[model samples]
Target: MTDQQTVTYGIDGMTCDHCVMSVDEAFRELPGVTDVRVDLVAGGRSTATVTSTGPLDHDAVDAAIDEAGYTLVAR
Candidate 1:
């Protein structure tokens, strides 16, 4: 197996559990993703810690957030 990789993403518009669920589902659909944790704090912002089987693609992650109707903050 490949080494696990972690990618942090700034998520916008996640105001509730449903929003977190949406983001979680988005990451789960990725081919190499292992797990996703969504943490929402002040300013209506959230952080997603994505664990994957190998190095992840930043553009793909951003695209998934966009498809989920949420904004992706560049890191």
Candidate 2:
């Protein structure tokens, strides 16, 4: 077993549970990703905490968020 590493990303345009699920599912599909936790804030930036076996690829994470119809911004 490998130790999990977590990273938080700031996301915009997530205003509901559906949005949270979308983002969660997006990150869940990535290789090495073990878990996803979302802190949703309506009408503003939300935070996504991702746990994986190792450090994740920023570009991949960005693309996944984009595919989920959201934007991942640096915080």
Task: Write down the lDDT that model 1 would get.
Answer: 0.87
lDDT by residue for model 1 over 1-75, one digit each (tens)? 689988888888888788888899999998899989899764666899999999877788889989998999965
lDDT of all predictions: 0.87, 0.94
Q: Candidate 2: global Cα-lDDT? A: 0.94
Assess every candidate by TM-score.
0.89, 0.94
Q: What is the lDDT for 37 in model 1?
A: 88
lDDT of 1 at 32: 96
Worst 10 residues of 1 by lDDT: 37-46
* Candidate 2 lowest-lDDT run of ten: 1-10
